[model samples]
Target: MKKWVLAFIAAMTFSIAAHAAIEVYEFDTLQQEEQFKELGHTLRCPKCQNNTIADSNAELAQDLRHKVYEMTKEGKSKNEIVEYMIDRYGNFVTYNPPFTLATSILWLGPLAVVVLGFGLIVVRSRKNKQVATEEKWDPEKEQRLKALLDEKNDGDKQ
Candidate 1:
């Protein structure tokens, strides 16, 4: 019983010490800290599709977090840090990227899809209407068809 208790205490102590290895940087001011948190939330982890740098535990996310901290400490403004991230990782790193020729596709793609979908729907509806109109009753044609069928039936009976 004594040995088991000692082993449990040792394990707990080691676990606590191990968790202390994750170092969090301190900011000089609350405003700086808030800015850091805001930037982290805004910037995406390069390798993560949906996770912000603040929420991701990926190696790339860790690196980016460290870079943001270092830039903040060096008195870099939020826009400067954001520009640096965008420059390094392309437009994917930031949610609000500046308009550029390369990013035009992202802005215009949905509109193009919607217009194409409407055009296809219009064409299909027109085609269906034409087919429906073609099948409308024609008295003369129907009378001719009825006579032909009657003649065939009479020949069969004969």
Candidate 2:
């Protein structure tokens, strides 16, 4: 029917409209293309908390991708592009941020935690060992316990 054909056409149009358009960049060399892809994967999207610019669909991510592509075309080295992004977006933009005083805690916190955990475990085990040794039967205490049991047995015999 005519109504069915119109509905089908409308559905198709809407489906196409809902899909996002992909951007295509032209590179003179294969190395440039590889650099672009690598930068895309390396740079984090400021708008998307955990997604790389390559994986994010946010507008900021698109802008960053374009910037990276432009920098690549300009014959900039990968480190230069990364440093530019870091200067613009702070260390949060790069997945591998450099070690500095501000980031020292991030790099050292896990090791500190592991060391502290082992220390606590060692201290706790020593304490447990001490308690076990204290609880072991000494001759004086063993004699007292035997005396008490003998008294109880004697009373029960009555």
Candidate 3:
């Protein structure tokens, strides 16, 4: 009975392993296969936070992979497949989205913020320097300050 249980467990493990096998795609030419792989790596999985389609195990990623395979088999150019994905899933589907007016903020916002911060620092620094220069002690003021300190020390001693 124990032998039968072990045998059943082993069979179940093998079945699960077989079921989890990596998906294989066939292409007519090596170029086509390379194109498919390139697209997979360049395309982001819509359902995942930041994983490429080639690295994601999401259902949407699988569907996208199958769609890419179908398109490749149909002799579609890489650009066409990319365009189709963009149209279907928006520019977020591509790791490197094209720069457009709508996406300009995404591409340029950091630089703008850095420039603004640097300008603010420069203005503040200039203001500080002006204040420091304006507050320079005159000789008369320094003499008066020393006299006051001397008088205070004399009174304390007395």
Off by over 4 Å in 3: 1-15, 147-158
TM-score result, candidate 2: 0.75
Listed in order, each prediction's TM-score against the native is 0.75, 0.75, 0.81
lDDT (Cα, tens digit) per residue for candidate 1, span 1-158: 99999999999999998885474889988878888999999999989968999998899999999999999988899999999998899999997777899988999999999999999999999999999988978899899999987775654786
Q: Which candidate should be chosen as best, given TM-score against the real structure? A: 3
lDDT of 3 at 153: 71
Instruction: Write down the RMSD of all candidates, one decimal each.
Output: 5.4, 4.3, 3.4
Pairs that collide, model 2 = none
Span of ten consecutive residues with least summed lDDT in model 1: 149-158
Worst 10 residues of 2 by lDDT: 149-158
lDDT of 3 at 56: 97
Count backbone overlaps in model 2: 0
In angstroms, how far off is 40's CA in candidate 1?
Answer: 0.8
Worst 10 residues of 3 by lDDT: 149-158
lDDT of 2: 0.94
- Backbone clash numbers for all candidates listed: 0, 0, 0
Model with the higher lDDT, candidate 1 or 2: 2
Q: List the residue pairs that clash in candidate 1.
A: none
